[model samples]
Target chain A: MERNNDVWVFIEQHNGKASDVSFELLSKGRKLAETLSGSLKSVVIGHNIESLAKETFRFGAVEAYTIDDQSLANYRTMPYSRIVNQLVDAHKPGIFLFGATIVGRDLAPRAASHSKSGLTADCTDLQISDVKYLRVDYKNLLLQIRPAFGGNIIATIISPDVQTQMATVREGVMRLEPLEKPGIGKITKIPYLPEAFDSIVEIIEQHRQENKVNLKSAPIIVAGGYGVGTKENFRFVEELAHAIGGEVAGSRAAVDAGFVTPDRQVGQTGVTVRPKLYIAVGISGAIQHRAGMQESNKIIAINSDADAPIFGVAHYGVVGDASQILPLFINVFKQKLK
Target chain B: MAINSIVMVKQVPDTANISGQVMKEDGTVNRALLPAIFNHEDRVALELALQVQDTYSGKVTVITMGPPRASDVLRECLYMGADEAYLISDRKFAGADTLATSYVLSEAIRKIGRYDIIFSGRQAIDGDTAQVGPQTAEKLHIPQVTYTEEVLHIQDGKIRIKRKIEGGYEIVESGMPVLVTVLKDAVSPRPYKARRVMTYKNAKTLMELEKLVEGNSLLYIDQLKDEYLSKNLYIRTFTMDDLMLEAERCGVAGSPTKVHKVESVVLGGGQREMFHATKAGIGELIDKLMVDHIFG
Candidate 1:
């Protein structure tokens, strides 16, 4: 398997709209393409997705390889994977990337396995590097960096033995680049025969989850952790958030303790939030937790442990019990409003 | 109709006690120094398997690849209601990454005979690759549903599953002989029954029995293993030879991805101002926060 000489991104779309992650990958893939002195391409597979293929070019793709058909209107495991694997086999790329969404997670593995390639999932970062290890010179290896061992440590991985290095980066991990210009690249429609629509998954029903918590764009968040102690004590966190007109979130520990619902968890396994102001109550900032909220505009940590890791990322730190300090903070806000 | 189901489990070092010494310079963990326990997600996966058994008539078989001491998690699985457990242990299987481990597990799964469904945790806490379950399903050439939050139903030879995506979940239906990698919050595992624990406490794998025989010259390994098997206390064990796996594909040799480097990350904000528990300190903090427009 020789080098394919290009970086490719899978432009994920549903109902004729492209996912934000696909655009982010295109932006990141553009950087890899520059480093490798190669072209950047986008792989689009869906019915009536020509608009998305054109949109990829605006995001920096030099080409879009698309497979359009009525069977691709709704995502099914068998057909989507077969088509992606077919493209990879036909036009081998130096690098391939997918969003770590449900669809991508379901499709990428089967495609990679079909090609006998290695794939790193849920990656946080990607880079190109040249290094020497074990007497092997890894020239321009894709640095697939991810949090491992339950988010206590970060590990960098590379597929030295295989071609077409693949990775599925989690959504929102990388910032999306603005469009350089629109429709600068070409769209090459790959042929898809009707027989390729064979699948075992029956589409019983598909709809968006209504009333989903919009944690990504929350203006402010009041989050609690293990130090909050009990389910009843979490109300202190909610009261402060309510008084400040913000949403409530919790650390993995708090969520595991049943103090809050899984939807309200603020960590790597949960949501990645960058609220305007993030108030972390009694949260000892594990890297997993920090990875989710470290990008907030202003951070204030309230914890009794003076050396807690959360303080390391806080714009302001309060060295006292949250239960005692939250009441005081709420009262002060009440007075200020009056 | 009854179906045969297998659950893949792992024993991981308790990373909550992770320290500088726990991680070797080569990026591999020093498992001897740290306390080992059942991987949390794998435990939840077993619970899901048991629940499937309770709903549909079936027997749950739990298998794991680790050192001989890993039999602890196996017996615990029995105490929690696994029908049978296997210890897939060998020195050659040490330091196995996801690829090697999945290879060995898939081979043993083939030897274990028929199974309608296979369950595993989405990712082990130690490696965090989330690769083995999917990789195994691929090797076995079966469909897999990962990040599974719940098993909706199983009827007419098809199973419905609700799986977690980025922001929400989607319900999917898969035909028979599918694999599912479960999430930690999928289900709360039932507590070990006191009676089952008392009955299975002396359960031992063949390796454990060999060790016991080594210390006592009067006892023979075969005799003891047979005795335990008759008493329903012997755990099925498999080595590399038992699974007929190539030596090259059993451990580190089969792993393609290498850890380039390991760095201990310590968070730093450059400065942290500490406030006393007094009212004056609280008032000053409020003023600073308000000035920064963090609070209005």
Candidate 2:
């Protein structure tokens, strides 16, 4: 089968549910498909994930290609990559997009490599350009735009020779299209046989702690930095997070200080988050750090230094020690909730 | 059985100190003014891989893709205890993002033939994309443990690793030939050994040797390569032909994505007003925030 016109998005999911970043990518894919006059297709790889295809269509995919093999039940790189590669090879798309999530990060590159295609990662922006044919001049052209250099510059890239363009976009930078009405999409299931390849690695088990928020999908986040003083001060930030019904995050500094594990870190070195409400406590906001969380819908910064760089990107600024202000804010929230 | 590990490293432009004149108007970074350094986290990754090799009594190979200047990092890798180093450099490999990069690295790995493990930093400091390691593992069809904080144990070809999850951590176990993307805190890269540094400092790639021969007719390029290879000082250089990579799939023609534009955004600070901790004032502040869409 020759597949040439559709745009494919890797729909990332966990625990039998869709990741928000998948929705974000689908939204972006919808716009791109519209620009290219093509259909938006999503590829989902998981075990017993047939029900999730409808949600993908609602998010903007016209069809969802699901690989529900038992080998793909877990988030291991090998099976996921093989499945995605098989789909891409079988159904050649003009463009492929993935959310730069942990799974997407692990899967997209491998698929691109296997396909021998180009991929741009962590793209904050994406757009398709049109070619104006001039009869007198006899000319045609194409254009692509994306942000570059720590978000310092925007670069327009064009490929005059290839049939497909692939990129992994960070989540929350794009908006998902609203589900207007229920739409039915076809799901084609593919078998995954682990024995097909000489399996070098096997996933033994998976675990998650109770009461921990998945920062990638959290709606509200309260993050602390080195300026939070010590490990104890991080608890103050946590108190505010709990009062706000949000998750606790930290900067690379906080992680380096042993205030939190590297997983909760929000920065270029950590996780990229786009929560609805991001409260940065004592974060000075280096560009590397802001690159991860600057996409949050609303950002409030609390720090002792008025000139802290975080205030530049913050929607609101509180000039006070986070140690004192966090507890006060938590108490205020508690009183208001009552 | 010892773990045979391969580490993917990159020599990136020191973008932290990039100045106005350091970048061309066309958006390409000027390599001259910007000192090329071993990517910080990749060094940390190399350290972790070396520690594993030391603990398991295996061999560690370091690989990088860049211009001839990339050999600097490869030699550093050898000095840091890498058993062998390969420099995958070609003019055709320029302008590659993480996606293209992982493809080239995977191809090189296939050429190197055998490996039980792979290690890379979470992301390169220059791009900060954190996509290459996982992408390479995906290409190689290997299971990957990303954001690894520590390797708990390796028993019976099953490697147990403590990886950082969203809020906490998960102990994941994968079998042999796993790709482990490490964090900075995983391990501090050991200092360069004086003997290894002195031994590999004379290491040269084919291009470098050609330039040396041009400067001195008495120095034969072939002889230099042989001597360096015998002394384990030569960076194994591979071309597209060497790796059996298709020309169309190896460079710009194989790359479909194009860079669109480059601009720097100078985010300015916002205005602020202080309020006393009065109950009424705090309520008013909350109301103002709600009005401004900051809170509801």
TM-score, every prediction: 0.91, 0.78
lDDT of 2 by residue, A1-338 (tens): 12266788887777677777788888878877777778988888887788887788887788888778666766766667766777778777878888877677767767776775666676656776543222222111224455455334556565434455677776655676756884677777666666544244455556656535479789899999999999987899888788777889999778878998766888754678888889898898876678788888878888888877788888766787777676667666667646
Docking class of 2: acceptable
**Per-residue lDDT of A168 in model 1:** 89
Give the alpha carbon lDDT tens digit for every residue of A162-259 in model 1.
77888888667777895745558988988887552255666666547543676777899999999988878889999999998889999988988899
By summed lDDT, which 10 consecutive residues of candidate 2 chain A come out lowest?
A132-141
DockQ score for model 1: 0.50
How many clashing pairs in candidate 2?
A: 17
Task: Report the C-alpha lDDT of model 2 over B15-98, residue by residue, as the tens digit.
Answer: 766666876765556667787889988999899888888788888999988988889999899888888889898888877666
Candidate 1: tens digits of C-alpha lDDT, residues B67-90: 999999999999999989999999
Provide the lowest-lDDT 10-residue window in model 1 chain A: A194-203
- Tell me the lDDT of candidate 2: 0.75
TM-score per candidate for chain A alone: 0.93, 0.75
Candidate 1 - chain A - TM: 0.93
